[model samples]
Target: MKSISFPFLYLCTLTAASSVASGNHGLYDVRPFTISLSDGVPRMLERIRDTELPDAISQYPGNEAGISLETLKAFRNQWLVDFDWFKEEESLNRYHHFTAKIENLDVHFIHEKSNEPDAIPLILYHGWPGSFLEFIPLIKKLTQKAKTSTGKHVSFDVIVPSLPGFAFSSAPGANWTVDDSARVFNTLMTKVLGYKAYAVHGTDWGTGVAWGQFDGFNTSARAAHFAMLPFLPLTPEQLEAQNITLNAPLEQFEEQRYVDWSATGSGYFIEEGSKPNDIGLVLYDNPMGQLVWIGEKYIEWSDPKAGTSPSVLTHNEILRIISLYYLTKSILTSGYIYFQNPLGQTGFRYNYTRARTDAPMLFSAFKYNVHYWPRALAETVGNLVLYRNHDFGGHFPGLDNPPALIEDIREIGSYWE
Candidate 1:
């Protein structure tokens, strides 16, 4: 693999300063900011907890369908009684946080540095119904020196950004695509933070942003890693043309996954991509609606075995995830991401011509993920370097299986030469 020239990435870094007037320049006034609850937000939330949630829960008892009413009530009760948002905020604020003006919007991110001079810079992007909070658990692990499989100690200066239209960050104006996010994020790393060359990892919508950095800004985005790839698996016709074959077990698993997703999992995609605003309006102020919509995915998409386990996200963890959306009143803006980059009814139809990246890319395939792409098909999108398959874990691997994900990331960082 070719490397970025030192002149392109590092020459400007030494001289770059924060604060540029209306341009993709260095981050200005990057200071510590707390996650303050919006005005009237606490009162509204209390009203919902004391009155609305119980009425909603009582109206639909015994789980006819959707989020189990009993389970939701239990979660709501814990959120009201036990879960302390202030305490959690304090824990979240333990890491360094900052906001940068890029593309006329303030992008919020956590920049945790490693003491090791040789540490590589790695930016992590989170996807829809997810936030930078997803990457919080991995911050300490990634920033500290860790022993890789090859017994080499590696550390990273980690940056986790709240994507535009997500918590704390400014939303895009109109028709904002993932490419726009990629461009701004590239600016964040090179122009703002003065890191000429850095690695990136993403999941869900984040994969699109990661691909954007890899393809649109290759000079600055040195290497890429993905739990989710830019493109989907090949069709039977394409698979046959390539003369690639899958064994009985692999074929069965792929077939079942496709069947299951097509039958049940595709509704959210269609609704969000087509009429995002319509749904957004309905759920904007309705905290229960927002919780049911987003929280259901949190439960359904995760590893079935990860029941109230810290190894995976706990009940409080899941509640905090939804609460962030509610508190920010960003549920509407956040859903617009799907409309901006519509995957459409038929999945895997992304324009492959545009899926070009020269940077070396690594993919870690978690078995229980929503979509599964064979290694052969995944290589067509980028300069494929490493692909590893894990026995356990699902969609949100950063939170679901931090140890394995961190190890895989460290292994890829070893190939930075």
Candidate 2:
């Protein structure tokens, strides 16, 4: 990977006033959003499955390059015969869905209010190849007041947004980066939701947005939790240079993952970041391409047995995610994120100064995730009030380990109370 110069743009701002803010134009209504796909899509998708997919599979039999033929076939059969988009839509509507105009785009989000006294208002952000759907499993748990082992009452009024250019949300401008995304999301929580201050939690690309809030709107973003640690870990040389001593065992377990991910797992990032349009255009009309592209992540990044037999996430769960991108015709725009913010071999290369804050922050380090760090390493990024290690979950913890994730979040909510 060649070093590409990043022309940094500073869009970071810090403001948390309670006064209602209208964009250049008046604020649009936060109206209910319905997840209805066009009627023709189901039949059309079925036709493609029955015809095009088999031919592609036959031609690329040893496509061990990506999702195996058997897995693709299973998804196709289930999508055609068993998967029910109507039922999934109904289940999605069980929560409050709404869209409001933010920065000249319709920003879609799930805003579930809790009646529990002093419930924390939190905005949970999801990363790429993930929708607001990732947080659905934990929604009901967080929205209702529950007692912790210590007998403390905790609940949250949760807001989960589809990142701009993904799923139901409108796409940002062609030049948008995570920083741009950060600003828009800050406006959403403070001005649209009418919350003076709130907590934030995120994983993957959502972590960038959460970091944005903490960096730009510290007054409004009171606390944060991250399933994906954003900043890179300190190298042994850096530790020695800074004369910092380690208190905990140097986690060679995490070090090995870094080596493996860098060597074999970075192709998608390069293609998406460098030439998003190249692949996005090719896959624009190819639903199978979209599924193969995104589905591969679910298979590789998630726990190996998660969607397999005794599936933690069933075939239906897998199909629902892919189906949304296909139905909405937004897969291209979502994939374009890589093009806008190109990551190099080292990792994310952003030009803005690292946003440091004293606000309480928590980090959940799951073993199977691509990146892991010790509590001491995580502390350098923020207030680092809590760091918990988990043995079983992988990158997609919302699905792989929702119960554990929810419990950790409930524990964090106690700080707000």
Candidate 3:
């Protein structure tokens, strides 16, 4: 492995008096920032090399049970021998980065403008375990002008922000909910960035924030797109009453997968939502521990063919995410949203009366996602104008299938009024 640097990341600071005048509510001066995980890499490498593992338990042929002991050993060996943090840092810094004061937090984001005259203002939101990094691959693709189906040339001024407490963004208060994030982000777009109207795309917990924008800020947030839906679907009986027929074989498979996930894979959801502090504190300074906790999700929730191909997320991609969390010292604060809005209690229920029918909505359903809702049932959640089903991707579509996700987002732009 290459020699590790000492200091982790360096931020170019701007004095408050020079950056923002007294009582100015807009962004305090969007300036260039660089990431150079200098100091943290050596310590993280030492920890990875010294990690202790227990004897492997006898199990099935594949990693169906969980991350096999062999997999863990391989990951450790890769970190010690092949993985390069500085190289990854350089790749990350290729995109322009900046930070601005929004609602008392230094919100970090990547703002890339298009040369096209009529470029659209679009914001992409990432969920937990994902940072602004997930959308980096899509920035160039989106910023270039391309013709839409209706002969309209469309390009975007893309804005990818780190959700509060995720990467470079400051952590939120304990009582913060997705609604609070929605308000702050809306302010970032309409007030700080001076965009009167914008569109949005979200996945995972980001879907919740996008929902808030659709429901509450519909005037400014004109159109929205989601890779995941935040609300639950109607029961089978309810769907039957509405004369909706589900494809039997596919429904069976989806149901079984959902049941299996709820039974075996919801432990993290329970822990993170109920006791975020415990897990967050335990893994705060432990790089290997963060890897195990987040790596399992990247492996299981992604497409089955992820690691075998470059198109989908690979082990190296997973390592980069874990490294980001560890170096930022944000593992603890990142889980705070789970505590603020318990999954089952707040956003999980199905309610027809409270749907976001104000704005035009689009959805891209990756077949392997842990949860599933047929287009028939999904359309009821909002004014769903487009629902495209994809057979190749999974939870993190931005990484699992960037080309497909990019196309879907462009299609949404065509539908934007």
Candidate 4:
């Protein structure tokens, strides 16, 4: 085996954080080492079929957004039959792809740079119930906008990586957490992609990973930003140690997260965080199950208070995300990631006393979710270069409101430049 010197290894470590953060994005001059997906995806599907669902219908807690006879038939007819993985695969494969062996597991990512080489690099992370597919439309906007906004003289290099046990990547071999996933992403940027500086934006689970990556990462990853910073109701322990109280103004952000956690998260949390393999086996097998499970996020993540009768996350976008997970057969492995994940540091940052990063953050949230009212909390955190609140959208804004999402990205890209 070849050996790397101290200085060289250190350089790679530092550059990793600043580089474009996904697979097959043309960040590396050398081709990404390929990994196997054929055997894994099919096996997952078979397992999903073998597992059985209860005779009684299962629906969301409290509000039963029951699938009507008509809707059920439609889902079974179209999603079960006509949903085409081949076409989606072809569309996704148009971008450069890369794979590399990291910690004895295969990692998959999309790494694409525009015509301009020095363009600022942006890494987009996907949360649970979604895959790299969520960023497809945004990738088009960011890459194209960077050029036009910059007079075609420069552009943005985009990296979108599937987290460990997601899509083409292998599940954790032993105990893992969001932080471990963050470490792998950091390694991809430095060791494989040869980048020393960059920025990251994540939603859902990706946001957790991004938080941890920036928390302890000993590199120049610039700054980390997220949509959901769910810290509600100062825990008893936090009170004991810090003597902090959740006053009227302080409780707004934390209270809502706790309310949602109690109301909607009971089932999803128990299954994914604990007995994942049981139901995950079924999701892996049945495409119908895949769609339902992945599609549930729209209802789950979208604030029920949005006033809109239906979720702002359009059906086409919802289907697109579910299709990726279903086609990849990553349902089981993705769930396994949650199982292996434990709170190395409680997963709850709870660091209100300390400023996270000096880098400016562009926190664009909607009034529907807790992200809406963060002005007070924003003051407690690091410098908020821009915090815009919209009356629409929810957890996944890109899917909820693509136009506004695009505008935010373009504006931030220009601001940072």
Candidate 5:
């Protein structure tokens, strides 16, 4: 793979109160950055256009077997002809993009402050096969004042940070864990950005970071919300021992879905956790390979009804995310999180006592999520003030169903104070 570098110039200055001088251990000056990929876009496009694809094999219709050959061909055609990276770049630059040195890493984030008087600070964390790009649409909505369930108007000073080693954020060392990420982010909010208290929302691996914040910085992380939880839930026998009645039908459905996913859809998990370097090196220079590696999850793990009716997770949306991963060349480091904390192995262990947090928590469970636990089981994990279930969304709720996610976040905000 050819070497790629981002030609970014610090364009704007921030208040002294919000940043420290350069060379300090704390947040070095928060400087605005622009995304530039001109150096490698031509080669990336050529690769996409010239790539060879095998004949379409249809043992079963649609994506039942895997990401269909038809899907790959369509995406390739769109990338070569219709997709415009510059236009996407312009759209992203509409918001404020900045990076501050935290823990010796250039932590990239989109920090949009609300003008509303009652606006609160909120930090969003994105997980693997995802980046800060996932929350672009949601960030705009969140920064605007909206009425909550209690009729109180609220807006947010939204902070969307690229997880270390995921987009613009500097990659961490081999031993770094989500707990380390939680500490740095907590410092980003409290020390660098100067927020006395803040709220948090997370999805995928971000869920683990949020859990760490909830467990460690309960005071400053005043309120918490999650679209996904990382801990394995208690077994049926364990729940029965606690006198918690299972919603039998729903449990049966979720169990079957889990079984099917474990059987077929979790190969990426195992590979990423066990041998990230192998797959990362293969996909690093291969744009189509990266597309298949990440795009397949966006298709299979999202609402099946997406791209119909309301039209979410469109071709452009998926392509933009893939492009970010390719252009940034962070695909290899992004998978390192899996190697550091392999779920269902040495990752987070479920302990009701340890999981409990004083901060109020809200959970929004989208039915199409790849993994699930009943509301009864989720409640025991934290101070779960609200657990809302949705029939129409998936792992990527921000794109699959923005309105529902927006509503849930606002509802959780009402519980913040």
Candidate 6:
């Protein structure tokens, strides 16, 4: 009986060891596989044509107004038919794009090589509501300027990849967060592209990934640049002590707008992070729902002048982002990322003003969004090399106001030398 008992225990222990080993061994090279996107489109379109999102109300005084009839009209006329995917596709493909396998997912990215040899390589990361298209205009001018006398692109060789579940990149597995996303991007940069050291730039959620990369990637990502800095953990007392006034206006007009954004604009964030799948299902089922969700951001966040802001999305930009998702069918996976790193949502909740990046961070703060002014906030992040209060450009500056956006990239891009 004692001999039989000992054998049974030994077998149990062996089984446990085998299971742990199987799960833990993915640290080796992560080669991704390509998944095509033909079947998913019809399924998504059928839902769009047939479905109607329940008219949900905002949690405020003008609740009914926020869910306005005009918003619906914009969705029908602009997003449904006017937006042309082929136009944006042709434009986006003009840049040098390449795809590679990273951590069990096929990753698609735009790699714009600079004409200059000493060009400092840069990687751009965009948050939700935008894709690699976010960085297109800036990249074009950087490569075009022939900036240096030697035509040596000085500071960066730009590499912009779609976040997992965002575009061509694979969606998150059961366990992927800002940390995982950062690590994969770093891998894309250092392991696959072979850059020993490089600078990273990002906006919105991408900012968090960029910061995480600074800590995770051993070889590169030592330098990080992000626009929306997280200062969540800090208390009100600490903020005042640091001379950071949350409600004070930097401009003389004196009305604080960020507080308004926190009250209203941040609802999507809570929805996505708290109930990602619910909203994702809506986005997945109704193409109109996806447009309402994403299209509004482009309208509210982009520059109003070109009359091209999300307020009135042209058929071009809106379809491009939606097509990327539809062609990929990554909606649920994209939303699931919220839960994977709940901490990532609070990433800006900390009190630290700046994490101190290694490279020169160009912060072209949007003129309208008062969340954080470019000049004051730059001190909290990196080597505040260039601070431009963009007269034009809202959230999607590169796309909203391309020519001005291009000029800024050309001017500061030469600094890599």
Q: What digit string (tens of lDDT, one per residue) describes model 2 on residues 1-417?
A: 011122121001102211122232135545555677757476547655655545456655764566888888877777788878888878887676667778787788887777675878888988878888888898888988887656788888888988899888888887788777878888888777667888999898788788878877889888889997555544555555756554444355555566567678768878887787888788776667777888888777766668543235666887888878777777889977777765531125323233566678888876667766666666666777777887667777888788878888876665663
lDDT (Cα, tens digit) per residue for candidate 5, span 1-417: 111123232322334222222223223556666777767799899889878987767575478777888999999999988999999988887777777788788888888877676678889999989999878878878878899888888888889999999989989987888988999999888887778888999899998898788778988898888997768655556667888775666555555555668779989888988899999999998999999999999988888888764436898889999999999999999999989986664354554444545778889878788777678777777888888888788888888888888889987667877
The weakest ten consecutive residues by lDDT in model 4 span: 27-36
Q: Quick one: ranking by lDDT, best first? A: 5, 3, 1, 2, 4, 6
Instruction: Report the Cα RMSD per candidate.
Output: 6.6, 8.4, 5.1, 7.5, 3.8, 11.1
The C-alpha stretches of model 1 lying farther than 4 A from their native spots are 1-29, 38-41, 50-64, 234-242, 248-255, 307-310, 344-349, 353-357
Best by lDDT: 5
Worst 10 residues of 3 by lDDT: 1-10
Provide the clashing-pair count of each candidate structure: 1, 1, 8, 19, 0, 25
Worst 10 residues of 2 by lDDT: 9-18
CA displacement after TM-score superposition, residue 2 of candidate 5 (Å): 19
TM-score of each: 0.86, 0.85, 0.89, 0.74, 0.90, 0.76
What is candidate 4's lDDT per residue for 17-134, written digit by digit as tens? 3333443333333233222333444544454345444444445533355334344445445543454445555566666555566766667777777555566667888877767766
User: What would the TM-score be for candidate 3 when compared with the true structure?
Assistant: 0.89
Judge candidate 6 at residue 163 and give its lDDT. 86
> Residue 200 deviation, candidate 1, in Å?
0.4
lDDT minimum window of 10 residues, candidate 6: 17-26
Record all residue pairs in model 2 with backbone atoms less than 3 Å apart, i.e. clashing.
Answer: 273-338
* Candidate 1 global TM-score: 0.86
TM-score-superior candidate, 2 or 6: 2
Name the lDDT of candidate 1.
0.74
* Model 5 alpha-carbon drift over 4 Å, by segment: 1-27, 58-62, 233-252, 309-311, 344-356
| Residue 240 of model 6, lDDT score | 61
lDDT of each: 0.74, 0.72, 0.77, 0.59, 0.80, 0.59
* Model 5 error, position 174 (Å): 1.1
